[model samples]
Target: MGRKEEEFGYLLDNNAANTEVHTKTGSTDQCSQHSSTETHKSLESTYLGSDDDEVRRSQAGQSCDYGEEEGHLVYHIGLLLEERYEVVSTLGAGAFGKVVECFDRDKGLRAAVKIVRKFESFREVAKSEITVLKEINMLDDDNRFACVRMLEWFEHQGHVCMVFELLGLSTYEVLCQTDFLPYSVDQIRDMAFQIFKAVSFLHRNKLTHTDLKPENILFVCSDYNLEYNNDTKRDERRMRSLDVKVVDFGTATFDHEHHQSLVSTRHYRAPEIILDLGWNQSCDVWSLACVLMEYYLGQTLFPTHDSKEHLAMMEKIIGPIPPHLLKLTSKQHYVHNQRLDFDESSPSGEYVRKHCKPLKHLQRKSEGERQLFDLLGCMLEYDVSRRITLEEALWHPFFSPMRTQKKKRS
Candidate 1:
């Protein structure tokens, strides 16, 4: 809407040093909110409905007869918008919007543009995402968090298009390709350190990434590998190269903001979120701990589907919730007295039985193993007040190996 030509030059000229990382974590129910049918589309549209000639004009072009999914507009490869970005490919499609790989003609950079449908809810989400990103981006000049950098954004047709730097494979992609083999301790340490820095940066600044997970964490470089050997018989040393950037800020909220009860993916969710207790940055630390454990064990630490079962698994693994925290939680019905006395144990028991061995596998007698457990214990601490803070985690002994290794390499 402003100086279109000058903004393109400024975006491309911006380097990694200017990239800001604002993290977002989400809940299964919160995620599902985006996945609902035509009813959701209408709600989002109603929420974002504004008296704009451009919106009505754009709506006129959106025909239900088009092959696009219901409530979604049709997008095709090679369709250029705003006379700046050309859609090279569709990266992924979600309930409200689709991400596309676009070639920025002005900057000659491959950018990922998230095109949100002109509906009000989608528009609000896009705008909120932009505001958070800008706030975080303004804080750091060195790009320590490795957050996906936002480039220029604009409105095209009836959609709000957000452009970001294109990043490489997600941790999920690497995990799947490697057949879920656990990363070596050293590699895991390095990865966790980077992740910790990102989380620390956000926490120190009073921001929280509610959705930290394998899928949202990605490698910063395209050429780095996690080291996999398909020949099962050969004994090969594990490759340790790693540098990750956290992405997806759709659900991130500030510390002062009203925290959501149902936030973050179920597996990595913190107890505060599950119990409807007020939460803060500690919630992200909880998710980060789960993520680190998965990196070392190649599976989710708590893999239950339902909230009660999830709480049960937490009890089994992390022990019962402290009384103080129990009182703070809104959903105390799940807890009986001082312990988590569940009426039915089938759902919780099912995953617990299978993962019991893997859970035990983490309890090696080695000192390194003990340190890992200590850090995890603090991170997974049920009480948000006593749980390890991001800064404390960075100073934890668990990362000493990474610090020593970095010094030696230097």
Candidate 2:
């Protein structure tokens, strides 16, 4: 059969950015074609295989001797799961679960089926992530946010399969390709605005994306034929927009109810959260600033460190909040001074004293760096009550020029 006529089926086009598929007769042919395209040049040739090299390498490292036995096991598992989708390749494996390649028989579609292992805690987190995704999908029908869309969910072989739209490259992958090059100011603004829109939508719906980072953002190609150069003029000015989709909602939580658990990636975690204080949707606002700073600066705003060092680092940047604002902290000691005392020798006091030096040193950086640092620092304050609100941040001068530049470019 011809390429287009070969038992065609529609998959949840996970590519997000580039949707067109230029098929070839074989994997070698596909590789050859892609090799000639500048945009795809950096992609490892093994990714084109029906079964990628990573899977082969993993299987080779397996202790099992029976080749057919393992294949048979997977086949039986697929059969037991109703065999609606053909297992094509493995996307990723993790402590929590493994995601496999699958093609849907009913729709003739491809999907990433995240298989939840039998561990109790693993299953719980997987279910929680699924719940978060479902909530997000139901909240917005337009799907403007960069979120992975769920195709289907089912249980089989003592595991739960979450079928998701397979995405192409993550921001992590793109960053690797560019060798950690900072994105153009326009690119930063565009990405930041889109992220803000997504966060705003979630906040409006009483939800908070507890984890926000570069790795969670996915890219779509505005022009597949175009080269992957760092030239912003060509990529930024393109009339057609083909990039969107954010993935991994495992740590997301609804803000309507108060949550006490300290959940968030370390570097992105707000100071209130780190200090074991009650926080609201504004925590996400703090993280958003950090993520945007990393995009523009090609480095993390506040690098990760031990809890003690991290607290010290925070104090250095935002400075110790006035006692009036300290009283607004949701923590009992700050509220009533009953449970704990904020004496000079206390952990809190020591953190504040040690961090003061670094904050003053950071003030001596370049103007652009200082501007970005100041903007992010305002939101990342240790005192939640003293931190800048999302609405106030949106009106800040740092973003005003960015907004004007974006409008002019558009």
Candidate 3:
């Protein structure tokens, strides 16, 4: 069976059991994994952010002129920005903007330039995104999280440009080509550590990535070539590495003192978000768990057809709530229609009994997979307060095997 089928089957078989599954037959946590070197180069560049709110508003008079070109206007870096960089090619395109190829004029190096239009309030949003990028860049400099490195930010012809380090293929591309390679215990452990470190850093800074998925994770070619067998194409090998640096902060929010906006991909969103419960950084933690699970299992843990069914699936896994967390729920309609009453033992037991049957199959899976299942289960707990903390997760036995292996090797 495929990884998704295996995961679903496991979940259905072992809803209540606490036993751990074994790893791959021949897999050992002591297996040698590839490592990489970090190189840094400095170049003279100008940085800008919102200096004056009033000045920003006044300058916002400029608007995106979509009518300027019949087809999309391809702006070459050397031609448009009068920089020494050569516009190499297009990296990727998106709704908000397109990342294009560029070679640094003075430094003689390759970089990706993200071009965004000038919207009325978009400048403020861009400024906010830049601020987040700067913070992330600083953190990455010291710890070296797997994330796209920000080179610089600038304005050209009423549009904002963000320069970033060029990396290999995205995880989405890799999964599509290889049909989602079965990650060995060591590979999964390494990827999980990188993801946890990234999310933990964001949480420490009171920042929520808001979006977490395979598509955002970019691979470095050397890493992929080392991990997987077979000499694949540059693009194919790039997909294999699946080394992701979280990108796209347009929907991210800061200032943990208050909730800003409801933002996140539906598949990765937490139950609190779907139920409109007052959410916090924990929501991002939940999403991270979903992404990590998807990577290992090759499909979403809570795959559903629609929002209603999705919510129901989550409710089933997490069980009923406590009075304290229920009071914090924001969606009155959802609470009225979907909320379960666990006040009584029999009714709540019945609820748990009914939902518990579907998860029995999870017991048959391997130990690494079971650990992931349990970790996801904890993250997906209905009561947000009862959810797993990042610190707690760091010390999980799921990670212990790898740590043990690392110590043995050392």
Q: TM-scores for all candidates?
A: 0.77, 0.64, 0.69
Decoy 1 TM-score against native: 0.77
Q: 1-410 in candidate 2: lDDT tens per residue?
A: 33321111111111111112222212223222222222332232111111112222232232222122222124323442455877775554433345666778888777777776554554565677788778888877677666678877887766777888766554434544444555555456566666666777777777776766555666544222223447434332231353656566655667655474565555567767755667788888887776775566455555423444454455555555445544555554343342223355766455445433453354434554566567777776656666777666666665676678668989
Best by lDDT: 1
Model 2 ranges off by over 4 Å: 1-82, 221-242, 321-378, 389-410
Clashing pairs in 2: 9-108, 10-109, 11-109, 11-110, 14-166, 14-167, 17-220, 146-245, 146-246, 147-246
Question: Per-model C-alpha lDDT, please?
Answer: 0.63, 0.53, 0.53
TM-score of 2: 0.64
For model 2, the local distance difference test gives: 0.53
Off by over 4 Å in 3: 1-82, 222-243, 256-258, 318-328, 335-360, 404-410
RMSD of each: 10.5, 12.6, 12.8
Candidate 3 clashes: the total is 21
- Using lDDT as the measure, name the better of candidate 1 and candidate 2: 1
Per-residue lDDT of candidate 1, residues 97-188 (tens digit): 66677899998888878777667766776687788888778886567576777877888877888888876666654554455655656667
Clashes of each: 6, 10, 21
Q: List clashing residue pairs in candidate 1.
A: 24-211, 25-210, 25-211, 26-264, 27-264, 48-120
Clashes of 1: 6
